[model samples]
Target: MEIAENTALVVVDVQKGFEEAGFWGPRNNPGADDNIASLIDEWQSTGRPVVFVRHDSSKPQSPLRPGYVGNDFKDYVEQRRGKGAGRELLITKTVNSAFLGTPDLAAWLGAQGIAQVVLAGIQTNMCVETTARMGGNLGFDVLVAYDATYTFDLEGPFGWRRTADELARASAVSLHGGGFARVLTTREIVDAAG
Candidate 1:
């Protein structure tokens, strides 16, 4: 798929909290950050738009709560943040969907004339997936960089447990087959976007 000129790469929930071993166990896509960083580099070089989604949990006990060390972005993300103002847009969200945040991602994308989105982030079944669904429904062309997002293993409502790889596959199938978004590796995305 060809990435349009009016596309933005949305980085979601890639904060330091996800790095806490106890908080997120048995994750897949270990190289997701490297892939994400490559995309960020390409975007920065090409002057493509980029948006970051930060999850600030409302629960006081959560390590991801604001002002906590875990709430800070990882160095890869922080370096981008350090690039200074107007370089990228930051949207803070408490929920699973980035669109439901304080700044209203959907509205901001529309205002910026973003027609297509390339997504890379944490927790495939949660925030990233929800954002893709909402973006698709909102009429934006959405593509997920599979190699640039990771997720932890999960226990299902039926008491069945899934490995991280299983969960990632399920999410990919759901997002692509459900018509929410296309799934591609980071290289494929960069080449397509190019």
Candidate 2:
């Protein structure tokens, strides 16, 4: 659980659009923002690299679409802008994985000699999970801050519904058990960082 000094914190898709519970349905982890803010503070204070991934939804009516205020980073993340020394990066992605984002996440991380990545953001079962899996597959040591990510309830095409908490737990199990990433809580990561 030792966090390397050069480890990168890749925050994925924590945008204002996600605040619209009406659009995303009920969500789990109301304190995800606080957890993410704490992690960012720790990373900035430690001078570790921080990568911010933004999701610019291509869907016309989506709240996260370009030109909308909802597409902007949340106030907490926005306020931390330029605080990561020169180790800060902003990636714009339309997909689920930050690795597939603009400016090339993997290549940039490689250039910085960062092999470890910690993930935290909105949608625990979607963008965050995808980025963690892809990061691990690409040979990076990946850690997922489970309590720093949130997800909404989802319904299957066949009429079954899964709660947000259920989905989050499932994602944790999948990532950890499948060997894609080490899923840990925000407290655990912060303690390790110390």
Q: Pick the candidate with the highest TM-score.
A: 2
Cα TM-score of candidate 2: 0.98
lDDT of 2 by residue, 1-194 (tens): 79999999999998999998888899999999999999999999989999999999999989899999999999999999797754999999999999998989999999999999999998999999999999989999999999999999999988999999999999999999999999999999999997
Range of the 10 consecutive residues with the lowest summed lDDT in candidate 2: 81-90
Residue-wise C-alpha lDDT for candidate 1, range 79-181, written one tens digit per residue: 8763532347889999999889978888888888888999999888889999999999999899999989999988879899999899889999999999999
- Give the C-alpha lDDT of model 2: 0.94
What is the TM-score of each predicted model, taking all chains together? 0.95, 0.98
Q: In model 1, where is the ten-residue run with the lowest total lDDT?
A: 80-89
Reference-based lDDT, each prediction: 0.87, 0.94
